[model samples]
Target: MAALGQHAVSKVKNAESQLVQEWIAALEASGGTRNVKGDELKADTREFLQLITSSLENGAGTAIGAAQWEDTRQFLERLSRNRAQMGQDSSQTANFIFALKGPFFALLQKEFASEPQLLAEQLLQASELFDALGLHTIRTYQASREAVIRRQQEELLELSTPVVKLWDGVLALPMIGTLDSQRTQVVMESLLQRIVDTGSEIAIIDITGVPTVDTLVAQHLLKTVTAIRLMGADCIISGVRPQIAQTIVHLGLDLQGVVTKANLADALALAMRRLGVTFTKAQ
Candidate 1:
């Protein structure tokens, strides 16, 4: 594809301020300026426009993948990630680049008004260039958003599995929601680490908030119990409700060799008894 012409580049450079104003106005009118400060938006538009004009002058063709466009690519990557972090959608992020097309085409039209064919050629090149950049911004935005989501998920996992010291030599893990292999791994790691940290002799896995219990959940529970045992700590499975008990029986899942309780209170009592600790009610 043909590169942006020298005449077009000169016009864009000379009309940089005008182009930026028009571009920013267009973006603002289209509601693309949401969540962005005025000064910051202007600064970004100014910088991007400058980079584009300079890169074009230096022979950066419509092929944005060219080496000459490396700086521009980096700029867009940063822009995309920042926009994603700012809670902007992919279309809005990409529109930051696509929005410039109008101002650029207007400049080219004025620059090549006398030469219709040349105007068309330059317009096409500019469109192609901006489209490529916008697509790159979208792709980068998606990747950044995915990274943010994954981080949030990991944080949620850490939050959901909290190990509390109920008494001396006893740790309690209150679990909510479903139990999958991924969550089981996190649970085991957290419980085991707490056991090591406090040198606790017993750990209770409470599932009062768990909505349902299937064979998979039982298996996960067993796995966690086995891991805790391997860590030299006894594991007590608590919160075995009537429905869950029936499910376990219906599934014929064997929780053999694992102590279970109807509630956390009972489990704590059992743990305390096993530790040979006795507590009396205050009179």
Candidate 2:
């Protein structure tokens, strides 16, 4: 904590500009500046240096979790998030903080050259503080990455369960993957909303691209069909290939009330007939 005292703090404050330059250089050499503009990088280094000096002057010690280090934490978190968004890994994000160690230690060594013990103490304090900040940056970066991944997964789910308007008062939802509870929920929400928006009376759930249909998947389809009936829309389950039909029979899964079709064309024709729509062949 003695590093927060007047002597060490003053030295850092007076050498802040030079420290930022050296730190930026260190960052550049460590590949921390990749994909970052030089001017923006310099600004960040200067701002971080100022935050550190200000925290030290305000008696914020090596314990980065203290309230006095709030600004520093905020800065590191923002930096970490930006780096994560830029597709940088945790090590690169952490290097942004760790690179400062070299320049900071050099500054302390030069300033406290006469007092070897004091120099060692200040260096230790700087090392611990920087290490803590680096770890914080890594944690924040990892959280940001997880958030990005979760959002992508949701987007993929929506993409996979696309609802198309196959005809007037008819909608088709073609599914392309294994049915899970989460995807089932997404499918229900999207189809139900489309039904409401289009006032559609029929929705065809096409599962030809679905790799397999176990008991759970059958249950999911049943739930979705039940939901569609509650919304006053009829649902047709399509893509019941021969293999799937055999599997359904083997599983003894009941589908007494639900309508099934063999493919998209048959489902669309059935839906069109239900709507009293007919086609004529022209020669």
Candidate 3:
């Protein structure tokens, strides 16, 4: 790709304010100004225009991957990420770059009116440069969105698995939702960490909120029980509704070594008995 002509660079530098105003107008017309503040938009537009002019003056050609365009690339990347976090989609983010095309083309046409060939060359170079930058913005936006989603998923996993201290030397983990390998790992880690932290000898896993008991869920329960024993703590499986018990029996799943109770209250009672904790009824 050819370098942007000096005439084009000078045109942008001379008419920078007009070009920014026109670009911002176009952006607002396209509904790209919904989430962004006016002051922030003006500052970003000014900075971007300055970066573009400086890059063109420094011989940064249509190939934005060149070392001379690194600053411009970094600026666009930051802009894209910010827009993504602000809930702007890829099209809106890229529009922020592409909106400048009309204002710039009008400037180029007037600057090179007497020379059509030079005008076309500069226009083509400018188009290529802006297109490349817009594409870079979209790619950066997608990556940032993916990062945000992954972080939210991690937070959800942590929120879904909560360990409670039921009594002295007793802990309870109330699980809801489907049990997958990823969720199972989170459950095991949270429960084991609580056991170590509290020095609790007994753990009650209450699955009253869990919708079903399948092989995968049973395996996850077994894994949690094994982990508890490894940490020198006993685990009782609770919330074994009649339907779940029937399902377990129908599937021929063996939970022989694991102690299970029909409800959380019974599990708590048994756990207290094993821990030798006694309570008296009030008159």
Candidate 4:
């Protein structure tokens, strides 16, 4: 009974010491913002440190979900020194790296003695965590990156949706971005539905915002034309800029047999003529 009581007391003291160290580390983690480059990066690093400490406390580093952080430490050490570093977001990673060292190594030498799988999983998470926090720290390729990712996701959602008609029978789709295969699918559906609902034989596709059309864009356009034809409508490719035409030819991509016009004016004129609305073209 006496021996067990002494062991328990020792454990309690160690636990108390660990708790004090954690608060100290947390304070330091928050204070090291000067060495960090940006306010956003500093905030992200601080948040990541909190998450690491939480995970360690949860036995996530020593138990089945615990990650082996040896490689992560070495990786962070390299990141800390590299100015031309590809992994800058992880620059302050070292600050939080050694914070959990004592507990992890103690657990690593014994707890994970036979649980290699848990070690592997934890290592995987460490890598993922590194990346999630890494983006915010990078100096180069930083500013527009966040916005670009956001726009890409938004554009992807937009592409999956069909076009809505503003008129009773006439259909109009104003495209703003590149027409990739994924987005082209949405555009095709919208055009087809409008033709069926209004019994309209003509659809005007305005592409004033499309910067350049590559092979994929050309393929998407072809697919749209095919779908519109099956729906019994005449599809017009409008707003074909001079530079876009040159790009199409430079790529050696064939867009032959597809109806195209110099601008929406010419396209609408031809569509109106097809619908039996004839107008005199002045010489």
The number of the candidate with the highest lDDT is: 3
Q: Which segments of model 1 are wrong by more than 4 Å?
A: none
Candidates ranked, most accurate by lDDT first: 3, 1, 2, 4
Reference-based lDDT, residue 26, model 3: 92
Worst 10 residues of 1 by lDDT: 102-111
- TM-score of every model versus the real structure: 0.97, 0.95, 0.96, 0.48
How high is the CA lDDT of each candidate model? 0.91, 0.90, 0.92, 0.57
Q: Write the per-residue lDDT of candidate 3 for residues 1-283, one digit (tens) a residue.
A: 6798886798789999999999999999989888899999999999999998998899888888998889989999999999999999889999999898998899999889999999998889989989999999999999999999999999999999999999989999999888899999999998898899999999999988889999988988898899889888999999988999999999999985899998999999999889788889999
Instruction: List candidate 3 segments past 4 Å from native.
Output: none
Model 2 lDDT per residue over 93-167, tens place: 899989989988888888889999878888888898898989999999999999999999988988898899988
At residue 187, give the lDDT of candidate 4: 72
Clashes of each: 0, 0, 0, 3
Off by over 4 Å in 2: 1-3
lDDT of 1 by residue, 155-226 (tens): 999999999999989999999999999999999998898899999999999999899999888889998899
**Global CA lDDT of candidate 2, please?**
0.90
